[model samples]
Target: MKVSIKHLFAAVTLFASSTVLADVLADIKPLQDRWAEVNYALPEDDREKAFAELLANADKVVGGNPDKAEALIWRGIIKSSYANAKGGLGALSVAEGSKADLEQALKLDPTALQGSAYTSLGVLYSKVPGWPIGFGDNKKAKELLLKALEQNPQGIDPNYFYADYLAGKRDWAEALRYLEIAKAAQPRPGRESADAGRQQEIAALLAKVQKKLKK
Candidate 1:
């Protein structure tokens, strides 16, 4: 078989891409696991240090695959989580970096990880302060979360985040509705830790909403 130079170059490019993608996935898996552990299981006092370690690892992943949206998404997720753990004026600086990473990820691939960039960005917009203090916009939060739901209508994350947002807006009935949907969400195979943690959150929020209804 006589392989032309163009065909050989194409084959090499495809193979390299696949290999790099595999490497990126491999790198991210452990980072994800550690992040879940730090966020959900570690004591609140210890979480800052643990998240800092994850941030370093996540940075390496992003550095290795600067153009890969998956890397950027994970980096954003880790940075945001780290910010939440830190929780102060300084935390906002970290969150701002996270926001940039997520926006870039959306630009690179809106559908990566089933629109996780949208889901994460939605969470950020909903939680951060609005206007002069920060860039949080409840309206934009709803829009981004709705886009996430359009991509993964039955996804636990989009449902739960949206529910949280509604609860913040004092829409108890709608919030409870989505919380129930999140409670009934099917678990992800390799994301057991995250799923379990989120379920705990869903249950707590569900209880709070129920209490609110009774008031």
Candidate 2:
């Protein structure tokens, strides 16, 4: 079979793009896994240092693939986690950077990584102090989180985050429902450690909601 030179070049270009994308995603996986470990298993005092190291690596990933929304989403996730770990006035700068990364990711591809930008942004808005303190807004958090749910209704992160939002609002019944959905969420392929760690969080939160119900 004879192939035209133009067709051959196009094929090579497509393959190269695909390969690079795959490699980028692969590089991000361990960073995510380490993040789950640091967030859930590391001692409180150790979290900041661990996240700082991970953030540097995440910055490289984002810098290497500025056009890839997937990379941007992970960058935002790492920044947000790091900000949470490194609280106080110093943390706001990191959180703002995270918010920018997420916003850019959303603008590039809202559907990337099953809508994780929305989830991360939602959590940020929900947790950060509002107004004179910071940019947090419960209303914006609800909007973003629900948008994330619309994109990935069955996703563990979406359900878990929404449940947390509801709990913060003191809407116990709705929070419990979402928590149950999160508990029953199917494990993500190749992310067993993260799933397991998140499930532990779900169980702890579930227990809290149940205790609240009894009150």
Candidate 3:
């Protein structure tokens, strides 16, 4: 079979692009793994310190790959997780940084990491104090979470975060529905630790939502 020169060039370009993407993922995998470890396995009292260290690594990754959406998304996730561990007013700045990272990731590639930027940013909007304090907005939170779900219909993180948002809104039935879906999500390869941790969260939320429904 004879291939046209145009077709040959296009094939080579496609292969190069795929190789670069694979290398990017490889570079970011450590950040993702450490994040899950710190967020899920560390003791509460120790998590803040661990997350702080992880944030340094994440910053380096983002710095090295400024244009890689996956790197930015993982950095955002780490910052947000660090904020959660830090808690209180002291964490607000870190949260804001997280929001910025995720927003940039969205601009670069909204669908990267299965729309994780939307999921994480939606959770931030839902959890942060609103008005004079932070940029929290329930309306915007729901919009972003819904978009995340649209991108990752069977994703554990998206479903769980959206369910948490619904529960906050006192929408018990809807929260339960999403929680169930989250609980049944397929295990993500190379993410067993994260999947396990998320499953536990889903179980706890499921129980709470079910109790609310019974009331």
What is the C-alpha local distance difference test score of each model?
0.92, 0.93, 0.92
Candidate 3 lDDT tens digits, 1-215 = 99999999999999997897898899889988888888788899999999899889888888888998899999888888899989999999999999999999999999998999999999999998998998899999999999999999999999999999999989999999899899999999999999999999999999999998998
After superposition, candidate 3 runs with Cα above 4 Å error: none
Whichever of 1 and 2 has more lDDT, that candidate is 2
Q: Across residues 107-186, which tens digit of lDDT does each residue of candidate 1 receive? A: 99899889999999999998888889888899999999999999998889999999999999899999999998888888
| Candidates 1 and 3 compared by TM-score, better number | 3
Query: What global local distance difference test value does model 1 have?
Result: 0.92
Between 2 and 3, whose TM-score is larger? 3
Model 1 Cα shift for residue 26 (angstroms):
1.9
TM-score to native of every candidate shown? 0.90, 0.91, 0.97
Off by over 4 Å in 2: 1-20
Tens-place lDDT per residue, model 2, 58-170, is 88888888888889899899899899989998999999999999999999989988999999999999999998989999999999999999999999999999999999999
Better lDDT candidate (1, 3): 3
**Residue 44, model 1, lDDT:** 97
